[model samples]
Target: MKVILTETIESLGIIGSEVKVADGYARNYLLPQKKAVLASQANRNMLKQEKARFELQIAKEKAFAQEMAARLEGTSCTIAAKVSDETRLYGSVTERDILNALAEKGIEIEKHMLLLSEPIKNTGTYNIPVRVYADVEPEIIVEVVAE
Candidate 1:
């Protein structure tokens, strides 16, 4: 049976994907659980149009992110943290900290956009990569200092 997935199905496909499933699975498991709808011509066309509009919006957002990234390149943001001693910080600097610091610098960025391997453990100068889009990349400086 042909079905359209309302959400991602493990090992199968993502939302808005059309997949073929067994009749028993579609009627008994999927539909009863409201996980998918039976594939029909009307729904297919509707999905297509919606997909097109969503893609267009994503492109526009990507462009805006790229412009913001360009403005953020080579910029430095300082974060003041409480220090226990001369060398170590009381706490680490997480991506949320970076986002808040950027906000203070008038460069607001979402936490998820910061492609960080991990939080900054020690206070020093660090290069953080902010992903503007799949194509555009921006690197910014983060200087962690003791308060």
Candidate 2:
């Protein structure tokens, strides 16, 4: 029997995919578990459309991320926070602090995509990697000056 999967099935297919499986398995497991449904003509067509839409959205986001990374390169941003006598931050600079500093410079970035080996602990210059695409990574300079 052919079924349209709503979620990934390890041995079968991914979400919105159509695959053939044993009728007993479909009836007793896949369908009952709501992992899939009978692949009607309408559903097949809808799934194809959905796949195209998802690809298009991903492409758009990749392009935007690339542009933002280009703008981020060769740019330095600063974050002012409380510091101790030894120039160590009372609390280390976090991804949130980095994002906020980027926002101040009109560069918006999500914390998940902001790659840092560790939080900024002492006053110095540091570099952070920003993933623009699978192959395109950009660096941003962070100057942690005493405040």
Best-matching candidate per lDDT: 1
TM-score of each: 0.61, 0.59
RMSD (Å) per prediction: 6.3, 7.6
Q: Provide the global lDDT of candidate 2 against the true structure.
A: 0.81
Model 1 residue 85 CA deviation in Å? 4.7
Candidate 1 lDDT tens digits, 1-147: 999886556445656689999999999999899888889999888778778664666567667867888898998999999888875888889999898888888887777778889878777899988876665679999999988
lDDT per residue for candidate 2 within 9-115, as digits (tens), equals 54675566789999999999999999898999888787787887656655676687688778888789987778896688888998988899889888877777778
Model 2: how far residue 13 lies from native, Å: 15
Span of 10 residues, lowest total lDDT, candidate 1: 6-15
Best of the candidates, TM-score: 1
What is the overall TM-score of model 2 with all chains considered together? 0.59
Candidate 1: regions farther than 4 A off: 1-42, 46-55, 84-86
Candidate 2 stretches with Cα past 4 Å from truth are 1-61
